[model samples]
Target: MTTIVPPKERECERCGRTDTWNDDTGTWAVVERDGDRLSGDPFCLHEWDINGAYNPLEEGA
Candidate 1:
């Protein structure tokens, strides 16, 4: 039997904002806003490179 695992949640290091990977949309959606910065206009302005990796997936055979 094979088991499928969900992607891990990602949080911003600067403001504590949280997001989750949406497999249906193939994108990340904001689930929680920690402060004004993340809650204000342009929801996600943080640099992802500095945020580090959030999810891990196995390569298909």
Candidate 2:
């Protein structure tokens, strides 16, 4: 058996935009804000902070 681990969430620190991983559609959707689902307001240069300290998929892969 193989275990599939999916990324749950990610946020842009520069613009305070958060996105949740959608397993059904296999895509990242923007989080709900102000009673509406927003998309592409302030296009920011996404810089993911993936560093040495963060390791989620390091177990028995």
Candidate 3:
């Protein structure tokens, strides 16, 4: 049996509320505000692990 890595339940930087992705849309629940800052966005986990986007929390976890 193959094990899938579950998406991390992360707290939004802006709202501080926890959210996750809706596998169907493949998008984050919250919108990213910072232009300069990268990672930890709504779907940062997916981006970092699956899509290869800017993910700052990669090292800490």
Candidate 4:
């Protein structure tokens, strides 16, 4: 027996924008925030919808 799982909704870590996998389009689409199904470019850095500011700190910095 094998189990198959559907792709889970993905949210942008920077803006909290959400996206769902579209089987018809065969691509991950932005389904929330300003873009909303327009494209995958959800985080513009200049504008973020989620809490907290954009930190440029690198790992171990």
Give the top-scoring candidate (TM-score).
Answer: 2
TM-score of each: 0.44, 0.56, 0.31, 0.42
How high is the CA lDDT of each candidate model? 0.52, 0.60, 0.45, 0.47
Query: Candidate 3's residue-wise lDDT over 1-61, tens digit each?
Result: 9975656444544535444555666555543455433344453433223333434344543
Model 2 lDDT tens row, 11-39: 76666667776778766678888876644
Count of clashing pairs, candidate 1? 0
lDDT of 4 by residue, 1-61 (tens): 9964544455555555565567776655566555345343534442323332332221232
Error of 2 at 36 (Å): 4.9
Best by lDDT: 2
- lDDT of model 2, residue 60: 33
- Taking all chains together, the TM-score of candidate 1 against the true structure is 0.44
- Report the error of model 2 at residue 22, Å: 0.2
Off by over 4 Å in 1: 1-7, 32-61
- Going through the candidates in the order shown, the clash numbers are 0, 0, 0, 0
Question: Candidate 1: minimum summed lDDT over ten consecutive residues — where?
Answer: 52-61
| Model 2 C-alpha RMSD to native | 7.9
- Estimate the overall C-alpha local distance difference test score of candidate 2: 0.60
lDDT of 1 by residue, 1-61 (tens): 9966555556565556666677887767777544433332355455432334334442221
Decreasing TM-score order of the candidates:
2, 1, 4, 3
Q: Looking at model 2, which ten-residue stretch has the lowest summed lDDT?
A: 52-61
Better of 1 and 4 by lDDT: 1
